[model samples]
Target: MKRKWDSSDERYFGIGIYRPKTVENVGSLWRTAYVLGASFVFLIDAKYKKKSSDVLKVWARIPLFQFETIEAFIQTVPYSCQLIGVEMDDSATPIQDFFHPDRAIYLLGSENNGLPKSLKSKCQELVILPGEPSLNVAAAGSIVVYDRILKKVNRSLLIQ
Candidate 1:
């Protein structure tokens, strides 16, 4: 589906989780993604269930793509759009230092286990949030989206 933003504003992004184990997390993440202007949300090897946490009924406002496998998801990534992985890994750049791509899709791992190595290797860029012992999947995804929005706003202010 076409995005709400105009063509001149090339920046657009989607957020999704891989093998998410909790419905609440998916609902909360979906709401956050919609509120933060994410172009879309997705699930990899998982299914979403209705939950009360999504007060905005984000399903109606945003698109959610489900892929049976990682390869299937990779096939749908838009041309020229980068796939970014959000995980706590030694090779990942810290969130504060990472630059938000003009067109990107941010993928987060499940609540129990972080991103698998195969998927992590495919990401053009991987960003790690602050703190140890990891964080809730929904919280981490929200932070990534928020950071992207914050940086974009700061960049526009500078250009003006």
Candidate 2:
């Protein structure tokens, strides 16, 4: 039996950053987030940086929320959403092997420090990329988004 197409797999996930150090990286990641079907993009402790790039200029289409702090952000996460921290903790599982939650808020950390302990404590799962535990913050986010899209692109979703 053929399954009907499901947009459900494409729109539930969100991508976020924890005080990203550079505007360019965040901008690039935001553009990729839109391509990967993220419902929206958010920033923790965002510096209220000015926009320059074409991607950064796009706010009307993809909403960008800036949280004053991680605590405030945590409080706002949807009740059904699962927070997935992108980190390299010893307990963290490889990204390739980890199963993405249905409603995921994929969180990337600062370019210099990765995720703060406070934010890490709030996440239900931590994922590390294969071989390289630490990647550029934007790269890490792009990879996660790519993984989610790949997971959603199964036989049923393919065109005949």
Candidate 3:
């Protein structure tokens, strides 16, 4: 990729995975986003070798925004998009039970604490993927993206 921001806005199904540790995981998510056609990525406390470098080569061509906190980032997203938080909660709906909105922003929490309680309050819904408790952050993100894309591609069949 040329590593330049594309004029085209990120697709309708774009995702915003919250603060993640390890560039490797971040890189992997970026790759997934690229495959999923995500418009851009927002990083909080993300370590960068350089603002623009080969390490960020995956996201170079994509629109990448850096923020100090989740609160700030969420403010920037358009109100029209549904902000979803992926977490393990008593009331969390299964990821499969829900339908992906035309404009959705899936929020992936950190590895240790999951999503902050305060932030979770803002999500339109909280979801949990059916699996072992050990699902890594990157894998969780990939699953959400895949699920949404599947629903989106099969919308016609679903209606019938």
Quote the lDDT for 1 in model 1.
Answer: 79
Tens-digit lDDT string for candidate 1 (1-160): 7699654398889999999998888888988999899889999999776765566778899998899999999999999999999999999999989999989999999888889999999999999999988899999999999999889888888777
Task: Give the number of the best model, judged by TM-score.
Answer: 1
Worst 10 residues of 1 by lDDT: 47-56
Residue-pair clashes per prediction, in order, are 0, 0, 4
TM-score of candidate 2 relative to the true fold: 0.86
TM-score against native, each model: 0.92, 0.86, 0.82
Taking the tens digit of each residue's C-alpha lDDT, what string does model 3 give over 55-157? 5466566766777876687788786788888888877899879887777777878776778888899889998999876588888889988988787768746
Error of 3 at 73 (Å): 1.1
Candidate 2: give the clashing pairs.
none
Question: How much lDDT does candidate 2 score?
Answer: 0.83
For candidate 1, list the clashing residue pairs, or say none.
Answer: none
Error of 1 at 10 (Å): 0.6
Scored by lDDT, the top model is 1
Query: Where does candidate 3 clash, by residue pair?
Result: 3-60, 3-61, 4-61, 10-39
Task: Please give the lDDT score at residue 129 for candidate 3.
Answer: 90
- Measured on C-alpha atoms, candidate 1 has an lDDT of 0.91
